[model samples]
Target: MLAYILRRCFYAIFVLYGVATIVFFISRLTGDPVSIMLPPEATVEQVEQLRRALGLDKPLIEQYGIFLANLAQLNLGDSLRYGEPALRLIGERLPATMQLAGTALVLSLLISVPAGIISALKRGTLSESGITVFVLIGQSIPVFWLGIVLIMLFAVHWTIFPTGGIGTWQHLVLPAVALAFNMIALVTRLLRSSLIEQMGSDYVRTARAKGLLPRSVVGKHAVRNSLLPVITVVGLEIGSLLGGSVVTETVFAWPGVGQLLIQAINYRDFPLVQAIIILLAGVFVIVNLIVDVLYAVLDPRIQYK
Candidate 1:
């Protein structure tokens, strides 16, 4: 298991490298940052001099080499627009993203677990039908749209919460719900299906035939086996959310990594953009590695070679 984990950590490095490479090139292709930086009436000389100062005058290959070399030393360079270390900016914004993502994850799990189990237990009944409809609607709603609607209802008309920005729990309510909407539906449906399938499995039948309590059989045996897929979704969702839910963050004006990324892209801040993407890719790789480790714990049948 340790060897497997070490191998995955090794692969994670390549994943981060690929992400950094792609983002570095793609950011440049969007447009030259110097163009936006200078005034319209600026002379060619001013643009060229500014480019040289920013090292944009260097060949693309040389820039890439510099980027990789900096990356080796864990240096993400400075944000072009912010005039601060890119890594430092990311660190400042990370806690906000973490707060939002954590709230969303908790909301998703709180709503999904019981809903999924009950929906499975009461299959072919009204409760199941209601849960199905709810999941369908939740999945169908676009996150950005949901965020706007929630603001209108909860913040504008009702005045129950602040419309945007972050501070208290009131400010968090709308955006978190909007971000969690699809995840809740996705987890609930996945868990429901998995539990239903597990209920029909041979082991489930054996547990029943042995006169075990129905609740125990369902909870201990079926739910445990059904959880692997749920865990995978949860792991991925947390990573994605932590990376930043761009739409939800934008809608709520939440000062998070997602909002920062949008600004960075708009300004073509290459160092900041690259830093954010690489960090997001690293989060995904680490979360997936954790999920793989959990598989062995959840089901000992899964053994690392």
Candidate 2:
């Protein structure tokens, strides 16, 4: 397992490098920061001087080499807009984004797990049909639209929660629900299908023939086996939660990394944007690695090679 993990980490380095390289070129294409930073009335020499100072004057290859060398030292550089270290800016906002994403993930699991199980167990019942309709609507609605509707209904009409910003628990509700909505639908559908498939397996018949109770057979054996796919979804969705938080945070005016990301893009802050995207890509890689290792934990037959 240790060897397998090390191998995955080795591969992850290449993945992050590729992400960094792609972001570097793409960010440059938005036009030079020198043009935006210096005033229009500034002389040509001032423009060249500022460009040289920022190292934007260097050739693309040289700049890339410098970037890679700086990245090796864990230096993400300072943001052009905020003049703060890119990583530091992200760090300050990291907790808020994580809080929002984590809450959404928990809410989805809390709701979806039970809903999926019941839908599978009840099969063609009204309960199953109702849940099916809920899932359909959950998946259909846009997160931003849901967030706006939530704000209008709960915050505007009922005055139940604040429209946006972080201060108390009330601030979290609207954004969290919006972020969790699609995930709840996705996980519910996946788990329901998996559970249904597990119930029809040979082992399930054996458990029934051995005189196990229906509840025990379904809850203990079938549910446990069905969890592998659910685990995969849950793991992958962490990154999705962060990405979706972009929309949710915007609509709700949440002070999270997603909001900061939008601001950075508007200003064409290359270093900050690159840092956020590459770090997010790294997160996805790490979560996927964890999921692969968890497969062995969930099912002993899944040995790491």
Candidate 3:
């Protein structure tokens, strides 16, 4: 297990490097930040000074080398727009994003698991059909549109929650629900299918034949085996929620990393953008690693090399 973890760590490092490289080169294609930061009345020498100050005067390769060196030292550099440390700015915003993502994850699981289990048990019933339709609609609707509709219904029309912003629990509701909509649909459908398949397996049949209670057979014998895939999907979704919060955050005006990322992009803040991308990429990598480790715990048969 230690060796397996070490291997995954090495792979994660490689993936982060690749992501940083791609984002670094692509950000330059948007043109110079100096041009965007400066006014039309600014002279050529001012632009040159700004460029030198930001180290844009250096060769691209050399700049990348410096970036790597700083990254190795856990220094993400200063935000060109805010003039604060990029990583510190990210850190400031990280909790809100995490709160949003974590709330959404919990909401998705709470709705999906029971719905999936019941739908699987009910198969051809009207309740199952209704659940299927609900999942379809949830999956089909765009998150941004859903967020707007939720804001209109709950925040505007009913005034049950705040329209946007982050301060209290009520402020979190609409955004979390909007962000979780698709994930709930996905998990419900996947878990339903997995449970249905597991229910028909020989082991499930054997457990049933042993005169075990139906609930015990389903919950213990069947559910455990069916969880591996669901866990994988859930873990990946949680990671995606961090980055995918962009649209939902924008629609709801939530103060989170996604919102910060949009502002950074608009200002052509290369360091900030790079930091956000790398931070999110690291999150995704770490989540998947956790999921992989969880496989062994969930199923004893899963052995790490």
Per-residue alpha-carbon lDDT of model 2 for 1-305, expressed as tens digits? 99999999999999999999999999999988877888899999999998887888889999999999999999988898998899999999989999999999999999999999999999999999999999999999999989989999999999999999998999999899999999999999999999999999999999999999999999889999999999999998999999888888888888888998898888889999999998789889999999999899889998987
For candidate 2, the TM-score is 0.98
The residue-by-residue lDDT of candidate 3 on 1-305, one tens digit each, is: 99999999999999999999899899988888898899999999999999999999999999999999998898888999999999899999999999999999999999999999999999899999999999999999999999989999999999999999989999999999999999999999999999999999999999888999999999888988889999999988987898779888999999899999999999999999999999999998999999999999989999998
- In order, candidate lDDTs are 0.92, 0.93, 0.93
Against the hidden reference, what TM-scores do the models get?
0.98, 0.98, 0.98
Please estimate how well model 3 matches the true structure, expressed as its whole-model Cα lDDT: 0.93
Q: lDDT at 163 for candidate 1?
A: 95
Residue 172 error, candidate 3, Å: 0.6
Candidate 2 structure lDDT:
0.93
| Deviation of model 2 at 66, angstroms | 0.3
lDDT per residue for candidate 1 within 150-180, as digits (tens), equals: 9999999999999999999889999999999
Reference-based lDDT, residue 161, model 3:
99
Cα-based lDDT at residue 275, candidate 3: 97
* Candidates sorted by TM-score, best first: 1, 3, 2
Candidate 1 has an lDDT of: 0.92
In angstroms, how far off is 21's CA in candidate 1? 0.7
lDDT of 2 at 53: 78
